[model samples]
Target: MGKKQRRMEVFDARARYYPSAKLTLEELSYWIAFSRVMGIGPVRFQLLLDHFQEDVASAWHAPSYELTRIGLDQRTVDSFISQRANIDPAHELKRLDRLRIQVITWKDACYPPLLRKIDYAPPVLYACGQLTEDDLHYSIGIVGTRKMSSYGRQVTEHFTKELVKGKITIVSGLALGVDTVAHNTALDNGGRTIAVLACGLDTIYPPSNYHLAKHIVDSGQGVLLSSFPLGIKPEAGNFPARNHIISGLSLGILVTEAPPKSGALITANSALVQGREVYAVPSSIFSNSGAGVNKLIRDGAHPVTEVSDILEHLNIHTVPLPDTSVLREPENEEERLVLALLSREPRHIDDLIRDTELAPNIVTSTLTILELDGLVKQVGSMQYVRCT
Candidate 1:
């Protein structure tokens, strides 16, 4: 049998196993399947949804004449009609479930509200890790060339560290160079980060960043996100599409360094088109890699000399102040108990555990949090004291 006929057989088989007649998952499967169709992209997908009263399953079965009448070109309609038979929504759902990936449709409550506001918002998001309320904070995008200069590297790290410290969630493409620096810096500083990928969640592109991707997932402080279907390869063309999601997720895009006509410049332009703020770091006028930054500054992109430049431009106040005076309050009974046990004079862990009648692990964990908050200090092995 030909590929087209084989697809038809698969679809017929999958239809028998479609989960009941419910409108949620079954409906979602149609959307996922439609996204996998060769010629249907964001705009056409929306057209299909609207033409079918938001019922993607019904839209999937819509006749080619109806699809063309609803605005898809004849070629696109023909492609969808043929490919719809080949796609198996059930198999897609099963694969995603087995891999533990979460598919967030536009209708899902946890979909990033800021990203949904864009005109070209993705209808679905494929995430390898969790998305939480904390991720919705004022987010920033950091982009630059894969080949970065020393100056570019320093600026990316400095600004990303400060932004993460201020509780701003960092968003990036998970590409090499500036994006890698941004995500790693955020994780290192105990801040949230989100990486938008140009490929599918099941495959990590650049191959070398598998460990980095794993760290993002395991950290629980960040997520790896994509709109591509399972097993999609990272093609050169996919990146421009990826750029839109990066800019859409962020409140602003920062171009740390780029030469003229770079992909980072494309993201900055997309941010402007999306009405998000764009910031660029100024570099030496003589540097070829700095050319894009200079032009962006000339064209009215905010020139960032410090992290405060971004804060001031965004009108964000109440940044988390890190100091001895600003230590966080004890979060639970265990933390309070640990703090109560500490004195100006160092006390051994064994003494605290015995005096408070707390378990060793609890005491150790509490002391670690207290030390991180700067409310306590370790003067020696297993010996801790309250910091004045």
Candidate 2:
């Protein structure tokens, strides 16, 4: 039999198994099947959708000739044909359900709004945990070198804590070093975070962070997301592509610390290409670990020193400070010194001490008094911000 005839025969045989009664599920199954096909990415899948009038089931059943005519190369058409013949779309959906993986397609209402605006956004996302509207809207990608230095660790933790205070959901690759620190800090601070994996949801890459991934899902703090179909391994080549999704899902990308050759830079580049803001921490010239972010700053990425820099650049309005006039006036010189040094921007106790030229004992006591008086609020750790 001819290729078209064979395709028809396969379709006919599976007609009864198709979830035709549930049009949405049926269409989604076809989309999942296409996602499993090699060589068919977001751009090609979109072409099929357009040619088939947004009917993914029709696209899946389209003859080899029709697929080729619609711009799929012969190689891709052959891959699709071979894959579709063996892939029972309904069975694929069942597998996802069994694994508790939620699939978000382009047509789904819960699809990330920021991600949808990117060029060649993934046609489907496999999520292993809940994705809230807050996660989709208030996320920032915090990525850096896997072999992070002490400075990198400190910077990542500091920024993560401050951003979490602003109610920003952190997004990271879930790699070691900076990515790990970003996720942990966000979680520790009781903020939601999302981990974008290069592999399928079935296997968490770097196996060591499995517990971390579990914590993210189990705590209901965030989600573990991927574009790759189940059974896909985390190959070296998958990461660069994965970086695109990281940037795509975020309102902006932040490079806390990265070497010149770090993959974090790739994500930053993707952010710039996607028209998303790219922020980098200023790094020392002597430090190799800081080269990538320093270059990023030189290339016009926003050099961020504080959380407000990011929030302001994104035009995100944080919670308005309470009016200080209602609060009791400062009772001592130490109280006035500390209050004068604090603002809506968070300031660490050490910085407050150094800036105010006060004793550590005095600064700590003044901050305690201010907290009690509602004149200053401790955002997290020892960081304090003015009530007004």
Candidate 3:
């Protein structure tokens, strides 16, 4: 099939599954076209709909002066009028069929219900994975900083593992540090994870996680998700919007570690605005990594001292860790020493070296093998933590 035809197939699939709006073929196109225009966000789009009574194509053709009467700014009203003739809503409608990617609009019943309550929910969302009502009803939002302390890493892994045991789908921006830790840890625990991106699904930010994204989708254990169309690139400002989406779809938000001004903090704030629960894992007051979490706790966010701290808050059962089993084979002498140094919290590598009485190179070598086998994870060059 041609790209256009495939795109239509996706739209058809979504139309079949969607449960809202008596959208005719024309209505979906008008809604999608409005969402694509710059300077016309969800709020302004609503004004247009209110006046046109959801006759989107008619709204698009309404006089510019009439739009202004409804209080659209002069520039935006003019912009809309000027773009109407050139913007091809039909092309986008056709492209959805061409790409073979499913499209779910506000009219669709399969649209994530939690997300609909957000302030600026997208008019249309594209899906690559199978998203059922069950997954939507059981998502847990996990977020953290791109640079993490050993303690932060441990907390994220521990909480994510517990969420997995509760049959919850983990959601996070696929950033480095805590986000990566959350997704991988959930997968490690035999659970599914969903990655919300700041860019299009066609583009992977922090390219290192590309393999992990593939791994999630390939395993039937998780999915890759995004709101941007196929061609958009990640801009710095896209992250805050991404944060809203993360908190929007989830039942709650957990901050494993972050600086006070970090994007994770923004997510917590958005969660609050969205009426979702916010949880934080306290870190050392001395470490900058823990400063955001500490502040969150001070501001009345719940504290998570252990996995159960969060599970208990959500009224979930925490699964006990398996008794330490013998490794299929030891990776190296350092594996023995590094393993000895590990506990529930991640320790700095220097701390590990001092405690293990091993050479740095040997310790590093062993940690690498342990990481590959999913038995251990390196939180820092000098520190390692067993997968929580």
Q: What lDDT is obtained when candidate 1 is compared to the true structure?
A: 0.80
Best by TM-score: 3
TM-score of 2: 0.77
lDDT by residue for model 3 (230-283), tens: 655778787888888899989889998989888899999999999889998888
Write model 1 residue lDDT over 262-370, tens digit each, in one string.
8999999999999999999998899889898899999999998888888887888866633224557788999888888777556889999998899999888888888
Models 1 onward score TM values of: 0.76, 0.77, 0.78
Clashes of 2: 0
Which pairs, if any, clash in model 2? none
Which residue pairs clash within candidate 1? Answer: none
Ranking by TM-score: 3, 2, 1
> In model 2, how large is the Cα lDDT of residue 346?
72
Candidate 1 least-lDDT 10 residues:
5-14
Which candidate leads the pack in lDDT?
2
